[model samples]
Target chain A: MAVIQRSRADKTGIVIRYVVLAVGALLFLLPFYLLVRNGLATEQDITSPSWKLFPSSLQWSNIAELFNNPAVPMLRSLINSLVIAVVQTVGVLVISGLAGYGLARIPFRYANAVFYFIVATLLIPAAVTFVPSFVLVSSLGWVSTLRGLIIPGLFQAFATFLFRQYFLNFPRELEEAAALDGTAYWGTFWRIVVPNSKGFIAAIATITFIGSWNAFLWPLVIAPDQSAWTVQIALSTFLTAQTIDLPQLFIAATIAILPLVVMFVFLQRWIVAGVERSGISE
Target chain B: MSTVTTRLRGRHDRNLWFLIFVGPFVLGLVVFVYIPILWSIWLSFFDAHNTVTPANFVGLGNYVDMLADSAFRSSLITFVVFALFIVPTTFVASLGLALLVNRARFAKTFFRSVFFLPTACSYVVASLIWKLSIFSGVRFGLMNTVLGWFGIEPIAWLSVTQPPWYWLVIVTARMWLQAGFYMILFLAGLQRIAPSLYEAAAIDGATGWKVLRFLTLPQLRATSTAVLLLLLINAFQAFDEFYNLLSSSGQYPPYARPPLVYLYYAALGQGQDFGHGSAGAVILTLLIALVALGQGRFLGLGRRED
Candidate 1:
């Protein structure tokens, strides 16, 4: 009888835990649900002064309307965002990867000092360089171009540190065997190291991609031209004071987050581990 | 003779390899990161506008002006208030979530992903979702609809700041986006704790609150400290959501502006005062550095694991 009672108590505990979790999950999901619900609602339906959960009719065409709107340039901005995010991710990976490998594998005389300097730069707030970086980019006449968006952000101190830490654990035998076969440092890195370090590279790449895709302030100031504006900057254009199109704005937001949502759903394991790794040091 | 020549060639090759491997990143860091930081500091001391070059050398004038400006002063207050509200709320919420998820028996990965999905959502997008869809002043909106169900009158969530209910929007949006990430950090910390400790505690008849207090919380000290520090830094970097949701056409209301938004307006908005912006940036950086340093010193962020 006592064992049965204990099992019953355990069942109740499990039920209570799930009940609490279900409520919390609803709280987390409510915003996304609201976004989709109103995103397909008519402007009149949305603005009407009556409480309703779902629209009488689903306006699936709102997505088309958002893309068709000339002021937002949704497609072009998406292309711009894609270019910026991809280029910056690739650039940081190459730059930081090379530096990490050099610091970890190469026995250069001043490697320790150089690594220290790079890590110290991570302490300096991005705000400290915010305006001057803008000015420098502008002075070079690179503003409103992909070069401006992609170049200044190509090197990441945190990502470099992450790479260095990972590389420190990399097995030396493979590289040594390559060296014994007369493979140079560059050749070994390109042929063996790069192929072997794909997991770390993917983790770093995902983190960098999300950051680049979501970047707002720098792109806002630099990419003044509609053609050069990223998806984030383009989404902000819908928020002007003149008129607030609720459906259009929601649609834009949905579109803005859709790629990230998809990426998260697909690569969530790496993304979560990457975020934890990034915070583990600091 | 050939061995000596080969040794010399090896030295030459090593030097070449070092430059090839490390030179690009170093040069990029020097020109883009270090140079801009120094230039920003220099610009803070002078009167600059529109251009990168400071037109006049005015030592401490911009700093004095920034301190005197009521807008900038209030922004500092606003940041403190926001940070105070967000830091503990997030810490507790994430810890609670982590503890609950840690004890969950089923669909652990599913629960983890559901909570963490928002961390990947961009602030700009999340802000719009809150501002436009959920918290919109319309009676038919999400929050208002829920209120209607309780027979309460519709509330204009984004407006009416005498009591500053708009903080609801800002606070909830940020918490939803960030709490899961911290929860994952806590979960990672939780997983690191040895099961033996918990088993030993249960053997001694410690259960419920005692186990949590003695075994769990103490074990998570390092992770908790790191989470708190990261939260503090991120709180200071508050710009995107505030700017996107609250700012109208790149101009912000005085009530909701944080230091970064205030500095953004001073530098980029109609006034275009780059000197003041740079000064404010420098001040903000110093404040963050001081906080981080204090936290590190007191919390032993750098203490060796003896």
Candidate 2:
């Protein structure tokens, strides 16, 4: 905690810190730089014997071509993914937020029981249910539809657990104050409880949105048809082939992930703070 | 829930709310998860020919036969080997990266963000990067393109696993995707360590290795345990990349795909061999349970429920 240390100790620590950080940063940045560079470069650059991270001339057409590639509906897929991601995020936040409040604040009997049951479900892998989920979606005629995609993800026990953890640490007097003003449980939940949970809600929503956006297996299983596919499903179809163009897949891969990365930048600092704090005692 | 005053001796309709919050997931699980799982189990014991006709039960014969199959043994071994290499290496690399980022005085957010960029990428995107650039198995591939500097001929990276090069492909893809995620977890753990601990170490002349060894390592036991368990779980769930990358041609390296991919191929890729696929699924569930139990025992994960 001292601002000043022995000159020798200070010198050694600074060198050690910067050198390790530079190497670590490079390890993280290289792959991403390659992915983005590959997407922007021309076929000649990609196929060239000599590698260059910087390109001679920017080929800006890859983005246009990526969207226009009728083989994949890039714009529509984005719209589809956006609609699904937003709606699912909102729905899950409300449901899990309320559930989290009830579990953490209400202190009712079977609160722990309900919590344990939901948490147990977390350990069950989706692959085990692959067949039946497919059959159920198909049976309900919801397969290959956005409804099918959005509904299943709306319920997340981990999200509930997250909100509950934050709620437990919250000072209880806010709810008590609202109650003294004649606020009902539901009224207090919507007003005082939710507004106060802005940071936690944002963290939960970001996590849920990312999960929904990156989802592949369920989307692939339920909507294999190109017309109904999310961009993730569409990008994966490039793989079910004899020979794949590496650059094109790189372009598509970049396209599929760019939006989420943008969203992540806005929320990473807060989410990391929240998730780390949650893990402090867990 | 009713007011605590009247509700002190009474129960809120707790299951109703639990159902509202967890109902969707549970309903989805039962309709989607439980039924399929139980069906798979029941179907595994039957000669279910992907037909509408009734499946005739054949007792434990399917389990008996799968246990004797060499392909089953090899795929199981492949999963185990992949886990062994990927888990410890990824954990160490991620934790090391976390410490570096944590200690850096400048641009900590930028470094953390860059480190985590890959984790947000979809598996298909990541897999395609490996497939087209590095594992293209052609002269144009990146690895070969790079090796051209040394005057070595193009080597087919994906197919030529006389050295099990497919494992390399799998590991490379995994490291790129996972290292950032575990880095976040480690950074989180790093923040929780009290500054006093480090200061105490400093007073004892524990500035570098001595401080790290005495302070950081001992303080990180639980986090390390969680990391180990999570890494193992993630490794065990290796489907997205393997499924996407497994070469349709015979160019696939020997023992390239894991049990899940093989199960997918069996159930859907080939003619419906649900019985075999179901058996594989059963084996996977059991394997996951066993591993969880082992880790729980080793880490004492839930022992001190504060």
Candidate 3:
């Protein structure tokens, strides 16, 4: 009878634990709900800011109106952001992956020295290089194109270091067996290492995409005209101290932020795993 | 002689293949990173102009002028103040959010996504939302509208430098954009905390608040340092949101004239003085390095952990 009573108490404690958790989760979710409701409202709704937790009317015109804004050029901006993020991710993955493989799989003198040198650059803040990089970008005649932005960020010091660590954890027996089978090392890399490292690749892809999307300093400096501006640059349209387009701007931001949020949601475990693996060896 | 030649050929082939394997990264770094850094250091000493002309050495004049400049000094102060508020506020808020999300039962993923949405936001986009939706002083902006319910009059949010309400706008902007990213980091740290510790605390007659203080904070120490240093560095590196929020005209000193903004005004916005820009860049670099190194020491980065 006492055991039965203790079990009931334990179940009650579990229910109480959930209640505490639910309230806390609500606090975390409030701002995002505020953003979504605000985004769907009309221009008039933006001006008459009542404390309506949900939108009174689903004024879907804001999205089209945003598309219609001449000064903004929405479609072009989306293309630019997508192309830059995609292309940069591809280039970064390929380069960093190859470098990682070489350090991990290859037996070469001075390999450790080279790896450390690349990793050391991670501590040097990007801001330090901002001014000079701008001048250098212009000197190379890459000032106005997506190419300028894409090329500069194509390989990161940390990404190379990250890939190296991931590759080191892979088993070497497969590579040895491939070598003994009279297979070339490059073929083995393509068939085995590249296919096997999808999780790390996804992790890098998420980091790079979000990073490219949010990148401000270089994009602001390099993109010569409004036509070439990334989505991030286009989203800066709500800039009045006295009066501003609240609903439209919020909607645009929510849309802009959606891709990364979705990616993170689907691959949450990979990211958690990635964070654990990164820089711990140093 | 043929045997020796074959051996030499074999060694050459292996070295060549090794280079090809690592070529992409090595080549990219040399072209993009190494060259840029060396050129940046070189250009810091030269009076560079747009025209392809002979660059003249300006010696230490640029650095000298930067030290004398009031705007440079103000910008540094502005950044320091920003870091002071943002680092602690974001860290605590994220930890709180992580604890909240960690305990959630129903639709936990959905709740995590909602919390993380703002962080994924592009800074310029987020800043635009803040500008239009929230602080519009016409009594119609969301924040002002909410304040109206409390009988508070609509006041200038970012324009007036008095009591630095303008500064407050920047801080809030940073806080909203940053909170979610750190929450994820804290969540990762929280996952590492043994469940047994929480159970032990509950059994020891510790209150919820005490359990949090004793259990969570100690466990999250490394993550706390990471968050603090990252926030401190990022706060000083504030460019996008600050620029988009303040610089509508792209030519003037944006808003109340932060140091980077002021430096941008001098270098790119008006005088087109790359020399002055270099000076500003060097000083900011030195300041950031000093702080980062100090934090590294505080974190005991050099000491090997067991």
Candidate 4:
């Protein structure tokens, strides 16, 4: 009798767990559902007193309309964001990867000093640097240019720290073999180390790409011109406009989010693993 | 003699490779980060109004003005209130989610993805969705629509400051965006706890809440410390959502202004008071460093054993 009672309680607990998780999942996904529902709705549907979860008919033309909107510069901003994210990702990977590997593997006199310097910079919050960096960039005539957006962000201290931590655990045997075969450190890094570190590289790449893609403040400061505006900047402009076309704004937001969402879906494992590694590494 | 020469050559080559690899990064950091920081400090002592270049020598004047300004002080207070509310709220929400997701048996991956998908969305987009749709001040807005069903009048969520319903909008938006990422961290921490610990607890007749309280919570100390530190820093750096959610027609309302937004206006906006802004920036940085130090010491962070 006691065994049966325990089994019954266990069954009830499992049922309760599923019920709670399902409710939480619904709450989490509701905004995404609303985003799509409103994006495909007409302005009438959006602002109507009587709310409906779905529009009367799907307005697929919202995508085309967003792209063709002249004042918003959606296409240009999208291209700019793409270019910035891609270049920044590649640049960070190469520069931080090299620095990380060097700090980990090279038995140089100042390696510890260099590593500590980079780590110390990580503690200095970006809030302190914002105004001065902008002034410096403006002085260099980089304002409203890709150089302004891309160059300053390339030297990421956190990324370098992460890379160094990753490389510290990297097996020395592979590099030793390459060294024996007359491959210098640079050659060994490119030929042997990098090829084997694909998982780590992919993880960092996903993070850096998402970060660059979603970046708002620095881009907002540096790229005020319409031509240099990233997608995020373009999306924000809708909020401050004299009149907001709710559907167009939602559609533009959808477009801005679609790339990262797609990327996240594809690289979810690496991103999750990368985030886990970062948290534990600290 | 030949062997010694080869050893010397190897050392020389290794040093060269080290410089070759690390040189560009160091140069970039110095040019972009270090130099600008020193320049900011220098500018703080001068009257650098409407220009990046230094003007009259005003030793400590800018710092004094920033400290005396009520608006700047309120901004600091605003951050404290925000951190107090958000840090604990997110900590609980994320820990709750992590506990739930960790215990989930069926479709664990699906639940994890659903919770984490919002992290990929930008703050601007999330703020837009919050301000314009879910928390929109109209009867037809999502929250208002739900409220109508229960006979509550539609509230102008963002504009009104008396009840500060805008806090609900701002905090909820941020919570949705960030809670999942921290959940992932907590999940990792949970996974790292040895299974034998739980078995041992069970053998001691500790079940359910007791096990969680005694075993799980204590085990997650390091993760919790790291998460809180990160959340605190991120709170201090709050700009994108607050700026996007509150500002209208290129003007931010004075209420709900965090230090960064206030400094943005003071320096980069119409005022163009770089000296004052730099002084405020230095003060804020010091405050953050102090908080981090206090938190680290209190928590005994960086002690070797987990």
Candidate 5:
């Protein structure tokens, strides 16, 4: 009798759990739904008191209008954003991967000290470097240029530390076999280590790409010129009081965030796994 | 083939390896992060206005001035208030979401990804969506539309500051954007807890609430502490959403200004007092350091465990 009662209770429990979760999911997804819905709505439709979740007419022209918004240079800014994210990701992977491999694999005097220094940098608040980094970049005439956006952020201490931690736990037999076969350390890394670390690389690259794409404050400070602005910086210009073009702004925001949404959908597994791996380090 | 020559060659190879492996990142770190931090500290001591270099040496003047300035003081207060509101609420929300997601027997990935999708979004895009489409101070805004179903009148969700209803917009937007990431963190923490502990407690006649309190919560202490510390740090660094949402009208409202936004205004906005900005930055850093150090003290961050 008790077992039968407990089974019935478990069935209802599962039902209750799903019901609650479905509601929570709706709450979480409401903004994105509104973004897409309103992006397809006209300014008249958006501002009208009558409410509809779906737009009566899809404003496909809004996309064209956003891209051609002369004041913002949406296309140019998108290209700039792409370049910054791609270049920054590749640069960080190479720099951090190599430094991480060295710190973990190579036995050198002061390696631990160097590792500690890199980790120490992680503790310092980013605000400390904000103004001075701008000054340093400005002094070098990098403001309003991709060089300013890309170079200053190329080496991430956290990414390097992540790579080091990953490498520390990596099995050493493969590397040992390579060494026995007369392969050098760098060659072994390029041939064996790099190939084996595809998952880690993908995880880190995805995160770095997302972060670089979404970066605001640094780019906001350095790239005020429309020509040099990233997509995010360009998107913010729509919110300026004088030019509150609602439809155009919604469409532009859709364009800005679309890549990330798509990427998250496809690469969801690695991103989650990557974060788990990093969390384990703590 | 002499011993000394062989030793010299070995040393040369090791040095070459070091140079080839670690040189680029160390060089970038030194130039970009370390030196600039030191320069910022130096710049804080002088009356450097708009320029990196100073014409006058004013020790403690900038810090004192910033403290005395009402705008800066109020901005700091706003930051604390904002953090206080965000940190605990997100902790509960994420923890709740984590537990719910973990309990699911099906579509776990679907629920997890749906919740986490917001974490991938740019604050700029999210803020614009909230400002223009959702909390828009209009009768047609999303929230207003829902409220209308309840026979309520149109309310200005973003503009009402006397009761600070704008906080609803700010807090919800931030919570929506961040809660998912923390949920992921908590989910990771939850999975790390061994299943045997729950089974063992159940065998001992402990049911749902008791098993959770005894088995789960105790195991989650480390992850929970880390999550809180991270939330605290990220809260103090708040700028993107607050700036984009509240200051969409071009000028920041006094009610919603956080330290970073305020310092931006003081130094780069009309005031152009770079030294004052650096001083504010230093003070903010110290506050962050204090929080980090206090957390680290109990967490034993500086200790060598291995």
Candidate 6:
């Protein structure tokens, strides 16, 4: 009888857990559902007093309307954003990877000093240097240029720190075997370390790409011209316009988020692992 | 003699290789980060406006003016209130989500992914959605629509300050955007706790809240401290959402102005006072450093758990 009572209680507990989780899931997903629903709705459907979860008919043309809208320059902004994110990701990977490997493996006289200096840079908030960096970039005539967008952001101290921590645990035997085979340090790194570190590299690449793609403040300040605007900047333009077309704005937002959502769906494992590593690595 | 010389040459080569590997990154950091920081400090001492290069020297004038300015002072208070509310709120939410998701027996990954999906969305997109659709003042807005079912009148969410319903919009938007990321952090911390401790607790007749208080929360100290520090810093650095949500027609409302937004107006926006902005930036930087140091000491960060 006691065994049956315990089993019954366990069943109820499981049911309660499922019920709570279902409610939470719906709450989390509501905004995303609304995003798609409104994106395909007519302006009347959006602003109508009587709310409906779905529009009478889906307006797929809202996507075209957003793209063709002259003021937003959506196509140009999208292209710029793509170029910037790719370049910045590649740049951060190469620069931070080299520095991280050296700091981890090389027993040079000033290795600790160099590592500490780089780590100290992490504590200096970006806000302190925002104005001066802008001034410096503008003085170099880099305003509205891709170089302006990509070059200054290439050296990320946090990425370097993460890479160093990762490499410190890497098997020295692999590199030692390469050294014994007469591979130069550079060759050994490129040929052995880089190939073996693909997982970590992918993790960092996803993070850097997402960060650069979502970056708003620096791009907002650096690329003031409409021609040089990133997709984020382009999105902001809609809000500041004299009138906001609700459907078109929703369509644009949906477009802006689509790539990231796809990337998350595909690469979420690496993204989660990378974020976990960052939290606990210290 | 030849053997000794070869050994020395090898040592020299190793040093050279180190420099080669690390040189470009260190150089970039110096040029981009260090120089910019020093230049900002130097600029703070001068009356720089509309130009990067300034000749008019005013020692401590900008700093004094920034400290005295009502708007600048108020922005600091805004940061304090924001941090006070958001840090604890996000901490609890993230911890709660982590506990739930961790305890889930079925479709664990599904629930985790659903909660974390919003982290991939940009602050800009989230702000736009919050400002326009969810919190829109009209009766048709999602919040208002739900309220109508209960016979409550449609409230102008963002504009009104007396009740400060805008805080609801701002805080909820940020919570949705960020809570998931921190949940992942807490999940990691939870995973690191050894299962033996839980078994021991169960043997001791401890279950539910007792096990949580005695075994779980204490073990999560390091993660909790790190999360709090990160949340505080991020709160201090808030600009994108506030600027996007509150600002209309290139003008930001004075009520919700954080330091970064205020500085943007002073330097980059209409005011164009770079000196004052730099001074404010320096002050904010120092404040952050002080807080980080104090928090680290208080929490015994990086100390060995065992």
> Which candidate should be chosen as best, given TM-score against the real structure?
4
Clashing pairs in 5: none
Q: So what's the TM-score on candidate 2? A: 0.89
Q: Candidate 3 residues B1-306, lDDT tens each? A: 445434533656656656877777888887777777666566667675542222798888778878888777777777777777788888888777787778766667776666665666677766676655566556777778778899999877756646467667777878877787788888888888898988898789785579878888998888888778878878877877678766654433433565566666666654567777766777777777788777765333222221
The worst-scoring run of ten residues by lDDT in candidate 3 chain A lies at A273-282
Please tell me how candidate 2 rates in CAPRI terms. acceptable
TM-score of each: 0.94, 0.89, 0.87, 0.97, 0.95, 0.96
Better of 2 and 6 by lDDT: 6
What tens digits encode model 5's per-residue C-alpha lDDT throughout B1-306? 245434533756766676678778888999998887788788889988778878799999989998999988988888888888899999999998999999998999899998999988888888888888788778888888888889898778767766467777888888999888888888988888888988888889998788778888889988888888888887888889888887855677777888888877776776667788888888888877788877764333333322
* DockQ score of the complex predicted as candidate 1: 0.54
lDDT accuracy of residue B131 in candidate 6: 86
Q: How accurate is chain B of model 6, given as a TM-score from 0 to 1?
A: 0.94
The digit string of per-residue lDDT tens for model 2 on A122-154 reads 565666556545545665788788888887667
lDDT of 6 by residue, B200-226 (tens): 998897967899998999999989988
Query: For residues A104-125, could you state the per-residue lDDT of candidate 4 as single tens digits?
Result: 8888997778877877676678
Per-prediction DockQ scores? 0.54, 0.42, 0.41, 0.59, 0.56, 0.55
Q: lDDT per prediction?
A: 0.83, 0.72, 0.71, 0.88, 0.83, 0.86
lDDT of 3 by residue, A1-282 (tens): 987997888778668766765675575455566678778986666555465566669978888887887755677878898999999888888888888788776766767677666765665677667676777777888887877879989868777777776677787787777656555657778987788878878877777777887887788778858777887776664452334566666777777777877877787666555544441333
Off by over 4 Å in 2: A1-13, A243-247, A274-281, B1-29, B51-53, B248-254, B297-306
Best-fitting candidate, measured by lDDT? 4
| TM-score value, chain A, candidate 6 | 0.96
Best by DockQ: 4
Q: Once all C-alphas are superposed, what RMSD does model 2 give against the true structure?
A: 3.7
Poorest stretch of ten by lDDT in candidate 4 chain A: A273-282
Error of 5 at B114 (Å): 0.6
